[model samples]
Target chain A: MTFVTITFFLFLAVAFLCYFVMPKQHRWLVLLAFSIAFYLFAGWEKFLFVLASALIAYLVGRKGTKSSLVFGIVSIVLLLFYAKAGNSILAAFQMKESIIVPLGISYYSFSIIGYMLDVYYKKIECEKNFFAFLLYMIYFPQILEGPIPRYKKLAPQLMEGHEFSYERFCFGAQRALWGYFKKLVIADRIALYTGEVFSNYKDYSGIYFFVAVLLSSLQLYTDFSGCMDIALGVSQCFGITLDENFRRPFFSKNAAEFWRRWHITLGTWFKDYVYMHLAIHPKLLKLSKLAKDKVGKRFGKSLITIIPLAVVWLLTGLWHGTGADYILWGCYWGIIIILSTVFAKEWKQVNQFLKIDGNSKGFSRFQMIRTFFVFSGARLLTAPGDLKVSAYMFRHMFSLWSFREFFTKGALVGILSVWDVVIVIIGTLILWKVDLLQEQGVEIRKKIGQYPIPLRWVFYYGLFFATLVFGIYGPGYQASDFVYIQF
Target chain B: MEEEILELLSAEFPEVDFTASDELVDDGLLDSLTITGIIATLSMEYDIEIPYEEIIEENFNSIAGLASMVERLQEN
Candidate 1:
């Protein structure tokens, strides 16, 4: 069951109640039961896949041998590849649909592989209990669209069940309410416009495509980060802290910084597992020396960045999807990052030549806006889910750019209703303001908690009621699934 | 060792001030790419292999950390 549904809320309530009621040592048992039930609630058909994958991981980790490590990594990677790319490969062979991909296969598979690698590398002692490892692989809060947890970081917390605290609950509830506001009030509302414009771009003008790309970018950020918020908030209520997946990504001044902030867990995963390893690999290091001696110091130094980043970006793209559009999107980001790193000094020199203080607040703001548009350009490539439409949008994206029409009833007539536009605009402003404050190191939830009881209750219940009242939930309106769940 | 390594790294990466911050890795002075470059330079110059376990932040945060790590690895 999706987090947005009433049934899931009921499930969470039951889980929450049982967790606090149970003894501390047995609380993990409660969590395990709830996690399994949550998975089964989604469907029993894919249950075996998760179980078997967990078993494989357990076996590999228990063995902790070189061969088993290879086996573990290969099997997990191949399973992920089959699940992600099976449909495309089947289509190529003119076969019908063949694979029933398990829930959170992409996420759990990576977690398990990371576990196996850690085991072989002797980073942490392998968990002696199979059930504990299984629980780590299938934690209910993180199973769907994870800030994918690391074993060393998350497993010990899972085993050591925490006593219930009123503070954690309040903090979690407030954060979750904010997440609901982002998803239901902002993202879903904007989806009405982006959904239509992307699906039927031919019906609208060039300005519409541009608007849709920007909106879809917001839709994705809200929907994905909204899910992360719910995941982390729910986990916190149970006295566990998951990693933060987003960090005001829109304010990033460059592609590298943006990736560092956005989907932070995924970026760290690639860096730790893939990029760092490749950079330190003997062969590549030798190649770097060769290039330095033969070509130049700069070129050799850049080789470290170029080679590992190329592989990391390609794999990153494939992880997102096996589609050509995703490949293009991945390459689009990869090239920008690689070039920026390779020519950072040259760019600085050029900036100096142009007499622009790159560190100035105005210039930083300009860079942030530039990064947003660059992100929106990548959105244009894959948001339509087809490269042809993306190409067409690119060709005519600036055709009928009339600000008067855009600002007036032109946007209101069918594209976006007055209410829809208002909610999204207000939501965007609130999101921006909150992010700005947080960027300046304000702990918003803590600040709210410091208020007197009456005022605190007002802030808490005000948000709760706002989400309940303004959230787009009525007959004829279906809440969109958290966007990253499909990945 | 600190002065020599600082000179070496400064000469290698003219963009960064090696002695500006002790928390180089934590303060974002040394990104992953730069860290790898430092590892390469250290490995090639010192003729010692730095294991993956040695890649922690404490070892890369400052020149003293690097010099100590290199000394320990060499003694090993």
Candidate 2:
């Protein structure tokens, strides 16, 4: 069940009650049962996929054989590909086409692969117990959209019995409420405009297209990061800490740093497992040497770095999908990152020549805004359909720029109501204020906790009711699924 | 070896005092970009193929750590 659903909350309540009432040693078993039950609710067929993944990881990790490791990883990769592109692959082979994407197969397959690699490399010991392994692999809260927990990071916590703490419960409840606020109040509300404007790009031009594209980017962030917050908050109730996925990524000064802060676990996974390995491969080393001989030391070495980065980006693109638009989106960011690095020296020189103080607050703010637009522009490639639509939208956006259209009745009324606009503006301001406070190292929760009980309850109840009243739902609006869950 | 590593680090990260700081990675004195550059330079300068497994914090967090890792790799 989705995080926003009433059924999921009921399930969580039952699971939490069962977990706490059980014996300390048997608590983990309860968690495993709940995890399996959660997966089963999605689909029994999908349940088998996760079970197979857990089994494969455990067997390969336990065996610790070289050939088995290779076999396991390759098998897992193929399974992932099937989950991602099974229909197309079947069609290619002239078989009956069926969409067989197992729920969370893409996410958990990576977790299993990572576990097997770590086992083979002897980074962490193999988890001998099957149930413990399954519990870690298919933890219900993070099973769907993940922070992609590592075995070393998550397994022990899963196995260790946690005594319920009132403080932990409060924290988790508040965090989950905040996550709902972001998803329901901000992302779902904005998705309407983005969904309309992007799907009907021809009908809208100039300022509308740009506004829609920017909203899409914001919606993506809020939705995905909101999912992570819910996952983390749920896990926190059990005293399990998942990795932080977003770190105020909008404040990033460049595309490279933006990536480092966004979907952090996925980036690090590729870095540690894929990029680093490819960067130091013998073939790449040969290429590096050749470049160094042909060109100079710095540029050649930069080429060496770019080669692996390109591979990472390509895989990253394919990881999202086999779609042309997805590949283009990946390449767009890859080129931006590569250009930033290639022109590092020249950019610095230009800044100095232009008497731009790189450290000034104004400069930093300018960089943040510039990075936001760059990221937002890149996200246009992720619009519905192929690159052609994005191209047309871009052409229209730049070629037909008009200030008056942004304020025109057609522009505002076609997508959102005046009330919706007001709500979105206020919601965004609240989100930014909270994020800014957190960025300044303010422990907001703790600060609130220190307040008198009446004040604290007032704040909590205010947020809870605000989420209830202002959240977009019922009647015409369906609970919008998180953006990253498709991947 | 420490002095040589310090020299290399200083050459790459001209702003940082590598000699004074021990928690270079921890303190954010050395980010991944700088770390990658150092790895390339060290691999080239010392003719050692630093494996992916060796790219851990303990191996590159400080001047001594880097020098010790290089020495150990050389011996191997």
* lDDT of candidates 1 onward, in order: 0.89, 0.85
Residue-level lDDT of model 1, residues A1-487, one tens digit each, is 9889999899999999999899889999998999999999878878888898899889999999889989888988888998899888999999986878888988898888888878788888898898999899999999999988899999999989898899899788778888998999898888888888878878777788888899889999999999889998999999999989999999999999999999998999999889989988878888888999999987887888899999999899889899999898889999999999899889999999999999899999999999999999999988888999999988888798877777775678667878778878888998999999999999999998788999999977877887788788878777988889988
Alpha carbon deviation, residue A205, candidate 2 (Å): 1.9
DockQ for every model comes to 0.60, 0.48
Q: In candidate 2, residue A216 scores what lDDT?
A: 85
Provide the clashing-pair count of each candidate structure: 0, 0
Model 1 pairs in collision: none
TM-scores, in order shown? Answer: 0.96, 0.95
Worst 10-residue lDDT window, candidate 1 chain A? A406-415
Please estimate how well model 2 matches the true structure, expressed as its whole-model Cα lDDT. Answer: 0.85
Which residue pairs does candidate 2 place in steric collision?
none
Classified by CAPRI criteria, candidate 2 counts as acceptable
